[model samples]
Target: MVILSGLMFIGISIGLIAVKYKEAYIGLIENRTDNLQTPSVLME
Candidate 1:
């Protein structure tokens, strides 16, 4: 019973880590897209 509970804890931790990773990846992609749409240019 103890082993099963330990395994369940590990599984939940891994799932949470995966979700955080996905959110970070999506945020990075969105930032890149926004930068591309509004590029900065120097005015002379």
Candidate 2:
């Protein structure tokens, strides 16, 4: 039970980290696009 709970906690933490990383990555891309004055559709 203890091991299972520990694994669950780790999984949740990883999921949160992944979500945050994705948000940060998208934010960086947006900033770069704005700086370059390029159309955002090009990014897609």
Candidate 3:
């Protein structure tokens, strides 16, 4: 269906953009993780 195709295309486009700006995204994630003492804290 056209709607499904459009959704897939948008999803792929967003994924590509994330990959292109992965460093910035990863930096954000790293800052978030820094607040936790360890990765196990995330399981809580």
Model 2: pairs clashing at backbone N, Cα or C within 3 Å? none
For each candidate in turn, the TM-score is: 0.81, 0.77, 0.51
lDDT by residue (tens digit), candidate 3, 1-44: 99999999999999999897998889889987887656766577
Each model's lDDT: 0.92, 0.93, 0.87
Residues 1-44 of candidate 2 have per-residue lDDT tens digits of: 99999999999999999999999999999999886896667578
| Top candidate (TM-score) | 1
Q: After superposition, how far is residue 25 of candidate 3 from its true place, in Å?
A: 6.1
Task: Return whichever of 1 and 3 wins on lDDT.
Answer: 1
lDDT of 1 by residue, 1-44 (tens): 99999999999999999999999999999998987788646521
State the lDDT at 29 in candidate 3.
92
Model 2 misplaced regions, further than 4 Å: 38-44
Quick one: ranking by lDDT, best first? 2, 1, 3
- Model 3: lDDT equals 0.87
lDDT of 2 at 25: 100
